[model samples]
Target: MSVFSDIFFGGLFQGSLYAMMAVGLALVWTTIGVFNFSHGVFMMLGAYFAWQLVAFGLPVVIAFPLAVIVMAGAGWILQASVVRPLIGRPNIVLVVVITTLAAGSLIENGALTVWGPRSKQLPSLIEGNTTIAGVGVSLHQIAIIVITPLILAALWSFLNRTRLGLALRAVAQNEDASQLVGLNVTALYGLAFAIAASLAGLAGIFMGGYRFMNPSMGADPLLKALIVVVFGGISSISGPIFAAYLIGFFEAASNYYFGLYWTPALLFLVLIATLMVRPEGIFASRSRGLA
Candidate 1:
C-alpha cells in the first residue's frame, strides 16, 4: 500500500513538472508552427542563473524572479535579432530549427566553460519531507503537485481573458488574417517566444531545487515536453497537462514493476505506439495530415 501510494503521488508530481516544462514549448509550437529545439537550453540557463544569484547572497525568492527576468529578456532579444529576420525565407521552419539548435549548442558549451562539468545542488524552498497517504514526500514535490494546476488555471485565464494572449492566439490561427486586422504578427511572435522562455525558465528554477543542476540537464525535459505536446494535441491548451499526467501514471507504474533501467525504453515505446495510432495527438480536433 505504501509503495503504491509512493508511486501514485510520485508520478503525479513528476507529471505536473513535465507539464510545466512543456507548457512553454506548447505555446511556441502552437503559435509559431516551429519548435524551439533550444527550449531546454533556456531551462538550463534559468537554473544556472538562479544558482549564481543565490551564491552571490540573494535570497532564493529574490533570485528566482531575477533569473526569470534575465532569461526572458534573452529570449525576447534572440527572437528579435536572430529569428525574426528569417521569417520569410524558403524553408523557414527548417532554418529556424537549425538556428535554435545551433543556439542551444552554443549555450550548452558556454555553460560548460562557465559552470564547469560539476553539477551544482540548489537549496530547497522548504526543508524536510511530509507524509502523504502513508508515504513520505519532499515539500518540493508536494508544492509541484499543487502548483501545477494553479499555473494551468492562470494560463487558461491569460489566453482566454487577456488582450495580449488573445492576440497571440489569433496570430496563431491566421497570421495573415491577424495582420489584416492590424495586429503586429512579428511582435506577437516575439511575445510568444518571451512567454515561452519565461515559463521554461521558471520550471527550471523548481527543477534545480528539486534535483541538481548540470549543463546537460535540459535534454531530458525537452524530449519529455515534445512527447507531451504531441500526445496532448498542439491545438489544445489542456492537451499537454492531460498527457503529462497520463505519462506520469504510466511512468510510475513502469518504475514500480519494471525498474529504472527499463523506463526509458518503455517511454520510447509508448511514444512510438501512440504516434502510430494518432500521429496528430490525442487532443487534436482534426488530423494534422499524418495520413
Candidate 2:
C-alpha cells in the first residue's frame, strides 16, 4: 500500500510538471507548424532569471512573475528575429529546426557564462509536509498539484473565452484564411511565441522550487516534454495534458520497478512502440486547431 501510494502521488506530481512543459511545446507546434528547439533553453533561462532576482534580494512572488515576463519578451524576439523571416521560405521546416537548435545552444552557453556552473535552488512557496493516504508528501507538492489545474483552467479560459485567443485559434486552423479575414498573422505568431515562452518560464520556476537548478537543467525536462507532446498529440491542448499525466504515472511505475537509469530508455522504447502503432499520437485529432 505504501509503495502504491508513492507511485500514485509521485506520478501525479510528475504529471503536473510534464503538463506544464509539454503544453507550451504543443501550442507552438500547432500555432506555427514548427517546433522551437530552443524551448528548453527558455525554461532554463527563466529559472536563472528568477534565481538572479532572488539573489538580488527580491521576493519570490515578484521575481517569478518578472522572470516570466522577461521570457515572454525573449519569446517574442525569437519569433520576430529568428523564426519570422523563415516563415515562407523554401524548406522552412528544416530551416526552423536548425535555427532554433542554434539559438538554443547559444542561449544555454550564455546562461553558463553568466551564472557559472554552480547549482542554485529556489525556495518553495510553502514549507512543511503532510500525509495523504498513509504516505508523506511535501506541502509544495500538494501546492503544485492544486495550482497546476487552476493555471491550466485559466489558460483554457483564455484560449476558449477571449477574443484574442479565438483569433489565435483561428490562425492555427487556417493561417491564410486568418490573414484574409484581416487578422495580423505576424503579430499573432509573436503572441503565440510569447505565451509559450511564459508558460515554459513558469514551469521552470516550479521545477526550481524543488530541485537544484543549473544552466543545463532544462534539457531533461525538454526531452520528457517532447515525449509527452508526441505521445499526447499536438493537435489540441487537451491531448498533451492527458498524455502528460499518463506518461507521468507510467514513469513513476517504471522508476519503481526498473530504477532511475533505465527509465529514460524505457520511455524511449515506449515512445517508439507508440509511434509504430499511432504515428499521429494517441489522442491526435484530424483538425489543426488548439481547441
Candidate 3:
C-alpha cells in the first residue's frame, strides 16, 4: 500500500508538471508550426529569474509572478528577434529547428556563466507535509497538483473565450488568411511565444520547488515534454495534457519496477512503439486551430 501510494502520488505530481511543460511546447508548435528548442532553457531562465528575485529578499508571491512576466518578455523577444526575421524563408521549419537549437545552447551557456553550474531551489509555496490515504506527501506537491489544473483552465479560457484568443487561433489556422483579415500575424506570433514562455516559466517554478535546479536541469524536462508532445499529438492542447498524465503514470511505474536508469530507455521504447502505431500522435486532433 505504501509503495502504491508513492507511485500514485508520484505519478500525479509528475503528470501535473509534465502537463504544464508539454502544453507550452504544443502551443508553440500549433501556433507557429515549429518547435522552440530553447523552450527548456526558457523554463530554466524562469527559475533563475525567480531565484534571483528571492535572493534580493522578495517574497515568493512577488518573485514568482515577476518571473513569469519576465519570461513572457523573453518569449516575445525570442520570437521578434530570431524567429520573426526568418519568416517567409524557404524551408522555414527546418531553419527554425536549427536556429532554436542554437539559441537554446546559447541561453544554457549564459545561465551556466551567470549561475556557475550550481544547483538552486525555490522556497516552497506551502511548506510542510500531510497524510493522504495513509501516505505521506508534501503540501507543496498537493499545491502543484491543485494549481496546475487552474492554470490550464485559465489558459483554456484565454485561448477560447477572449477576442485576442480568437485572433490568435485565427492566425494559427491560417496565417495568410489572418493577415488578409487584418489580424496582425507578426504580433500574434509574438503573443504565442509570450504565452508559451510564460507557461514554461511557471512550470520551472514548480520544478524548482519540487527539486534542486541547475543550468542543465531543463534538458531532462524538455526531452520529456517533447516526448509527451509527440506522443500526445501536436495539433491541439488536449493531446499533450492527456499524454502527460499517461506518461507520468507509466514513468512512475517504470521507476518503481525497473529502476531510474532504465526508465528513459523504456520511455523511448514506448514512444517508438507509439509512433509505429500512430504517426500523427495518439490524441492528435482531427480539427485543428489550437482547439
- How high is each candidate's TM-score? 0.95, 0.96, 0.96
lDDT of 1 by residue, 159-248 (tens): 999998899889878888999999989888888888888878878888998887999899999998888888887786788889989888
Model 2 spans with C-alpha error above 4 angstroms: 286-291
lDDT of each: 0.86, 0.90, 0.91
lDDT per residue for candidate 2 within 1-291, as digits (tens), equals 999999999999999999988988988888888888888989988888989899999988898899999999999999998899999887887999999999999999999999899899988879899999999999988998898889888888999999999999998889999999999999999999999899888888888989999988888889999999999888889999999999999999999999999999999999999989987789986543332
**What lDDT tens digits, residue by residue, belong to model 3 across residues 203-272?**
9998899799999888988999999999998987888998999999999999999999999999999999
Candidate 2 TM-score versus the reference: 0.96
Query: Residue 16 error for model 3, in Å?
Result: 0.9
Give model 3's clash tally.
0
RMSD of 2: 1.9
User: Which has the higher TM-score value, candidate number 1 or candidate number 3?
Assistant: 3
Instruction: Give RMSD to native, each candidate.
Output: 1.6, 1.9, 1.9
